[model samples]
Every structure is written in structure tokens, then in C-alpha cells.
Target: MSTPDPDPDCPSTPTTTGTETYLSGGCHCGANTYQLTLPAQPSPPFPLVDFDHCTSCRRTSGALLQAWIILPQSWAVFHISSTFDQSHTVYASSVVTAGALRKELGGGEPKSLVHYASSPGVSRAFCARCGTHLVYSRVYEEREAGDGPEGEGDGEDFVGVSLASLDKDSLERAPRPLQHTWWGDGVPWLKEMIAKGCEEGGIGAMEKLEGYQ
Candidate 1:
């Protein structure tokens, strides 16, 4: 499904607050969309950004490296495209609070949104039709022994949004990777390549391509 031109009633522009900046993103097919409110500087560490290389993340995303921008559940709002015509016209859309979205995944509300446990207690949400991985989340009981991947279950009542799903402008404005997660699980060659890229003169000294000499 494709998102039609934004109806005045459904403005797609990003907004901001005194201390927060808003960014928007969605699935490739535009079946699902969300807004993320982040701090202008830094706060509760909610808007945490990091690169992940765990086996589960690699397998689930089919990518060598994955980046996640995490925040509190209350900091996001999701829009589900519900009504449309044969011409791919979006006639009606509904807003789903992050809490409600979490509770209704794979059940009701936001029919296009679905999720599955990539591992015990950890659910990954994606678009049913476009297959765009959107959110990662897990809940824990008080004093419960929550153990899994390096970055999973480290926080409470938080959801991690895939950096890959952010829109162009938002992605460009997203924060830099704060750290590397599950570094040991990364492929050896890929790790070497990344290390080289980080070295002072390594990237520029490597073979030049297309536009560069």
C-alpha cells in the first residue's frame, strides 16, 4: 500500500517542542508510520542510539549490522492506515498510542502491524504487508532474571525503533551510533572492514570507486 499525498487533516510535517525534536518514519509501503520525540540535548538516556551485531539481529534483519534508536514507550505515537480505495488512496487513518500498539500487536487494532518473539520475552514488530521491521521490545517482571542478547532487556518499558525504518530526513538527522552492541558476534571480515573505516587514514587510502578518483 502507498501513502497518498498528505491530507491537510493528516499533516506529515515534523514538529518540535522547547526541549524536544520530533522525527517521523514508516514502512516502505507506507502502511504504517510513527513519530518519535527526542530530547534536544540528552535526557533519561531514552533516545539511546547504538549499532548492533548480535546473531539474532543479523538473522532477523538480514543485515550484517543493525542500528537502533531507543526511547520510552510514551515518546512515540503510531498511525495505522486503515481505509483506502482501489487507487491506493488513503481515506482514513487512526492514531495508536505506543502502549496500545504494544498490547494489540498480533491481536487487534493496527491490522497491518504484527509481531513475533524473536526470542523468549522479546517481541519484534513489523508491517504485515511490507515486512518492514519497525520496533523491538521486551517486558520484565520485578526482580525477574531477564537475560538474552547484549542490548535486550537492559531497560524497562522502552521500545527500540529500527534506524533503517526512519524516513530520509529523520535518518539524516538521527544521532550518531553511541556504542557497539554484541561486537563479539559480528563477522570477522565485517569487523575488520569497520575497524579500517574508523582508522584515521584507512578509508581514504582504500581503493577509490565510482566518483572518487
Candidate 2:
């Protein structure tokens, strides 16, 4: 069966927008740098934002909450460099698909980028030099309901970037996470804090320790 046409208004498709904005970011040690092209006011969540509470995400990131932004791989341009510095060159200039980008990077261009299989068919990328968690990806299989063939399924590759990896300006420009994922895997207190914070008005609901103000 053929794949369905992509939705033009979907947040995943940045090319549908009239105006474009670029967000530049990289790992802490600058080993991996990328620029994400987004719509001026990208849909509701052009760069789809969310908080991942999965145990794997928490353990890999070593953070209480792991924030991520999802987008099509075609929207991102990666900069590869032998030296992690301001001067880096773009390796793959053409638009790359989600699966293609993973393969290209996995070939070891920068030599600092490393990939780990967090679970079967689930991969996570990080900077070996800086130890900064960078990306999480998963392969999803969709089997159309029909009597075509046994175990026949189409695979979709998705990529999610670490929100904290974005530059200061990009982080400020990015939208706030709209939802929580893997809530069951989250710490109880952290979940309560989020619930209460939403119930009240923002961070004001949380306890402000000494020198916090």
C-alpha cells in the first residue's frame, strides 16, 4: 500500500509556512551542531514540545525532567567538525530524511557523536566528548489492516532533540512544553509539583527556598 499524503498544515511540515525562522543549537562541547528551520509562528507547536518522563529518558539524561522537541529531519541541518569550535562545516547540504540522517551520522563524521540503543528499535544519540544527551529516536511499524502478506508493515522513523541542548536564544524563542509523556514513569513529587503549578498560576505555586527569590 502507498503512503498517505503529508498534511500541509501539520506542525511537522515547516515548508508549508510563509515565513521561516532558524534555531541554532548543539551539544555542550560543540561537537554536534544543528540548525532547525521553523515557521515564524510555527503552527500550534511547529517544533513539537513535550516533557518525557520515561525511565530511559531520565536515566540517559540524568535529569528529573527531560524535555524534547519533535520535528521532521528535513528541517534540520547538521554541522560536522573535526574540532569542536565555532568554525564547523556542513556535512550533508541536501535535505535528509529521518532515516538517512541517522545513517549518515552513525557513519562517524565528527567522531564525537555516539549512538546507543536504549531499547530494541529505540536509539539515542549523544556527544562522547561532552557527555551531553542529544537525540532520541524510535522505529515504529505500522501494519495496514488487509490480507496482503504476513508480517508486512511500514516502518516510520522519528527523531526528538533534547530541549536543553538548544542555544540560549533558541531556547527563549522555543515554545513551552504543552504535555507530559510517560507520566507513570515520573517521580511522584515531580508530578505533583507540575499538577499544583498548573492548578495555581505557574512556578509561584512551588515552594521558594531561601535565596530562591
User: Which candidate leads the pack in TM-score?
Assistant: 1
RMSD of each: 4.0, 10.1
Residue-wise lDDT of candidate 1 within 1-213, one digit each (tens)?
555454443345666779988888887767678888887776546577889989988888888888999877778888876654456455667787676676767564437678888876688888776788888876655224555333445555677889888877788777878888889999887777778785655544566579856
Q: Estimate the TM-score for candidate 2.
A: 0.69
How much is the lDDT of residue 208 in candidate 1? 59
TM-score of each: 0.80, 0.69
Model 2 segments more than 4 A misplaced: 1-18, 40-46, 83-99, 108-110, 140-156, 198-213
Q: Where does model 1 exceed 4 Å of error? A: 1-13, 83-88, 142-156, 198-213
Q: What's the distance in Å from true for residue 92, model 2?
A: 13
Q: What is the C-alpha lDDT profile of model 2 across 1-213, one tens digit per residue? A: 222222121222222235886666777655566667776665433467889898989999999999998765556665544444333322332334445656756674455567798777677888766778988766554323442112322333446879898877778877688888889999987887777675664444656688957
* Global Cα lDDT for candidate 2: 0.64
